[model samples]
Target: MRRTAISTTVLALTFLAVPATAQAQTQYTGTNAPIKVTLTVQGPDGLLFKGKVRTKGHDVTPATGGTHTCDGTNAGANPSPVPTPTAALDDAARVNGFTWDGTWYASFDDYLVESVKGVKSDATAYWNISVNGTSIPVGGCQFKLNAKDTVAFTWTTL
Candidate 1:
């Protein structure tokens, strides 16, 4: 009984010594405390992917989405407003996106999808983004996301 009491006291002190910021970090860690969301990728032929993916809110990462041909490398990249781990294009890319091609447009400080799942955007047709069935004014990388939100990418024409 005496040994157990001493061990418990030490454990309690160790936990108390930890800083508040460090304990809170787990909530901000994208993979550690993830948020669930819906992702829908609609191709010209049909739907490419639809499922739930885990994501997190974060401080805006400039020019971030992936490490592909056109991801997170713009000279004019700027961080978006901090909301809970944003589930924009970066989340889709992390979850179920494939073979994506996008451009980090410094003019808009956003990312535009040029191709995804082998489908390319043409002069007439392009990939558009909608959150919960409403079209977004900003690029996919700039759009914010919330839990249970449905992010849809549809291939369409002007």
Candidate 2:
């Protein structure tokens, strides 16, 4: 009879402990955590342009020209052609701690430039969305016509 009572008590304690353990496990599911990120882009003359981008949802913004703003969704429209550098060596120093070569040029369109190491030209440009720094690989966003002479691109977190 004593053994039976002890077994019963042990079973009850185990049942009580199970729920507490399960509850602790559920708290770490991480379903409500926010994602963090950083973005960077390089231009001519060591001009490093950086922006804080969020990945919560879709967002769109206007494009910029070298000097003055342009019209229509396509900012590349007849933009004042800036002289492209003869060699990558004559470009500005890499911005945001990344080293790059060659003269950088800005288009009427919005693009991102990614930094790489070892390669002669460690900078590459994306059409719509570009990865500028070392961070999560967010996909590229495309440019759309917002209004007359206004174009925008939207990036979203997946």
Candidate 3:
């Protein structure tokens, strides 16, 4: 009779511990956590496009470090590189039906922003990138993303 009681107690404890362990293991990591990126396209007049893009399903990770750093991830299952700023623009375009055009430079995969919402970069002003008001040292294609990042592409001489 004592053996039966001990067995039942042990089973109950095992059942209780399983859920706790599972929850801890399955908790959200950078891979599964929801990420939000705010994007803005500016022209000489002021703002052209601004919005937030969020994804919770895809695995997103921050870049290690440096001027060439930008958030990157695979597309679904493909191993191809996708930069955070580029992804943000793509997300905004998909969400709002906004059209954006860019030109890729050499073999670096760097993108030069040409136009957004019909505003073209002219001779006097060129499109430039900034994050949270600070100019990005790297090109858009190389910029890595962190969660809730603010990415801006402005057309100005400055």
Predict model 2's lDDT versus the native: 0.24
Per-residue lDDT over 1-158 for candidate 1, one digit per residue giving the tens place of the 0 to 100 score: 65345433432342335455533432221122455778788988898878777765343332324442122121212232322212344566654535566654455444456667778776566676777887654344434455687878788764
Query: Which wins on TM-score, candidate 1 or candidate 3?
Result: 3
Which of the predicted structures, 2 or 3, would earn the higher TM-score when compared with the native?
3
| TM-score of candidate 1 on Cα atoms, chains taken together | 0.59
Instruction: Write down the lDDT that model 1 would get.
Output: 0.51
Which ten contiguous residues of candidate 2 have the minimum total lDDT? 83-92
Candidate 2, 13-129: lDDT as tens digits: 322344544323222211212223343333333324343322321222212212211121222321222211100111212223434322112331322322222222221221222
Q: Candidate 3 local accuracy as lDDT?
A: 0.53
Model 2 segments more than 4 A misplaced? 1-34, 50-53, 64-139, 142-158
State the number of backbone clashes in model 1: 5
- Per-model C-alpha lDDT, please? 0.51, 0.24, 0.53
Worst-scoring 10-residue span by lDDT in model 3: 58-67
Worst window of 10 by summed lDDT in candidate 1: 69-78
> What is the Cα-based lDDT of residue 37 in candidate 1?
70
